[model samples]
Target: MNTGKVTLLSAGPGDLDLLTIRAAKALAAADVVLLDDLANPGIVSLAPRARVIRVGKRGGCKSTPQAFIQRLMQRYASKGLHVVRVKGGDALLFGRAGEELAALRRAAIPVEIVNGISSGFAAAASLGVSLTHREHCQGVTFITAHLQDHGEPDWAALAATGTTLAIYMGMSRIESICAGLMTTLPASTAAAVVQWAGTADERRLVTTLGRLADEANAAGLGSPAVILVGNAIGEAEAFTVRGFGRAASEGLAHAA
Candidate 1:
């Protein structure tokens, strides 16, 4: 018998090869694939028999609204179609999967989750950096600059324990975050932004807290990116990462 359900699937960061075998199977069996911009299209192509729906919500671009996306999932599932909502990274993180889960539940549709690799891990791997460096950061926090006019986040808290902070979708708010961190993190504190992370055209800006914002802006590092702030970022400046700020920490060590 056909099932009416929506699977909130994670397509991983960018590399299609990172997809899990089960996720690959789901994609193959999906009757409709609702994919976000961050989720690679090549991965979805595996589900050639399914309807491909590009619901990429790029910042400042024409996007299918969140409500609309949820409604589509529910509507499609009601028709006994297997809907696979492909999200980049993990669906439970900043992907706003809760809302869709609620919508599906209210409609009494079956739902499942297929986890995927996250951008934080992918970006860190591409740069050979660790979010939990034993000598520096002990924990990691994943957040997003998800506001239009929201004030700066609490730098004192973010800087207090030296935990790694991985930000997604914060290109526009980079200035505010950097400025806040500079107050306590020092100008030399390692900081970086990875653009097109885990992809062939990936780029990394290796700079200190003070220059992180300027370098990112100057480089035009826009959406579909990740920002990491912490001493662990020192690894990103390594030549192997093809970084831009080779000497970004020259004077900050003395300041710290």
Candidate 2:
């Protein structure tokens, strides 16, 4: 029996519309889909013929083990099934695609990758700001706050880069992240947080580094959010302090 292939599909940032054409096609032909916690559950509509498996991986919450997910993919593909491992945001950006790719290769299963919009870009879009503006930032850097070894990245070095910093999975350590970067960057440096970017339930907080933690906490922004810090953030349309609690609309404060 011939072994099947695996397609690591990017579901984009919780928005079904952000899903790429190629990704939709892959889903339409899927045999088994391993969905992530962040991906829109509505995406399963495209894969009507496939068996949808909720292999949710969420930070700071109960999640399906990476090894187990890999084993499931290997098992399904070994039986000649077209396995689609759906991930939120760009699959290559901190979605553990490397491990899945390596595992599939070891098992001799052909793999295909379909890219989609990352949350960093979506966050910037939500704020109507360019992460790498020629006048503001020389470039942009995408980094994860959480590391496999549980070590934090060099915040001072990153701050010195003079580029827009789009930090992922850092909401839980917003205070620490702000403190580390404040060591190099100014306390008044522009900072923003976009939660559930590109989705209807999206919320945003725009403030300075010194007040990011406090403002974000007061607004009740939580995990699965993108933390953006840098001078480029000052270029955002509404660079002034803003909050998004359970109910918030235009003009900063939470709605009464």
Candidate 3:
């Protein structure tokens, strides 16, 4: 009997357009799809004949167990069903793809990974800036503010790297994250937040490290957001015009 395979397909933030052609083709051929919380719901249409299962894993909310999701994938694939695990953003980027991959491998199930744009990149695009601006930073660093131990990351050490910081699952502890980074980064260091990046409801806020938390709070920004820090964020076209000044900050509270 021919064994089925599992395809770990990245959904690319919340934009259907950002979904890669290969991902779409995989979806079309899928017999079962495990959809993630952050992926666009419209993608279900791509797999019209496939059974879609929502195994959402949003922070601060009830989530489907990882073990159960893995078991479902294994069970289906073992029955010669083409299982597609659809994840938001790049599956390899904090999407628990590593654990799923390991589980599939141990089960001897054939697997393939289809890469897609991450939310960090979408956030950068929303701000119209390059994360690795030659004059500003050497490269980019993607880190999650949420750790398995619920402990904090070495913000000071990360700051010392001099790379653009793209922080995920950070809005809930924006203040502390900023405070940790402030140990090495100056208060005037540019910071920005992009909520629901790559979607129609996307909102952007540009400010300094000192004001990021407060500004984000004032703007009613919450989770499902990406926090960006470094000189590169200052290069955004709207940075100077929408940030810095008290008047502009006040306006941004309502506008952004």
Q: What's the lDDT for all of these models? A: 0.81, 0.87, 0.89
Task: Estimate the TM-score of every prediction.
Answer: 0.89, 0.93, 0.94
Clashing pairs for model 3 are none
- Candidate 3 residues lying further than 4 Å off, grouped into runs, are 237-256
Q: Where does the lowest 10-residue lDDT sum fall in candidate 1?
A: 247-256
Residues 61-158, candidate 1: write the lDDT tens digits.
89899999998998889889999999998888877898889888888899999998898898888667788988886899887777546665677687
Residue pairs with backbone overlap in model 2: none
Using lDDT, rank the candidates from best to worst.
3, 2, 1
Comparison by TM-score, 2 against 3, better one: 3
Predict model 3's lDDT versus the native. 0.89
lDDT of 2 by residue, 84-171 (tens): 9999999999989999999989989999999999999998877777999788879999999999999999999999999999999999
Model 1: how far residue 229 lies from native, Å: 1.0
Which numbered prediction scores highest in lDDT against the true structure? Answer: 3
Residue 83, candidate 3: how far off, in angstroms? 0.7
Worst 10 residues of 2 by lDDT: 247-256
Task: Give me the candidate number with maximum TM-score.
Answer: 3
Which stretches of candidate 2 lie above 4 Å from their native place? 1-3, 238-256
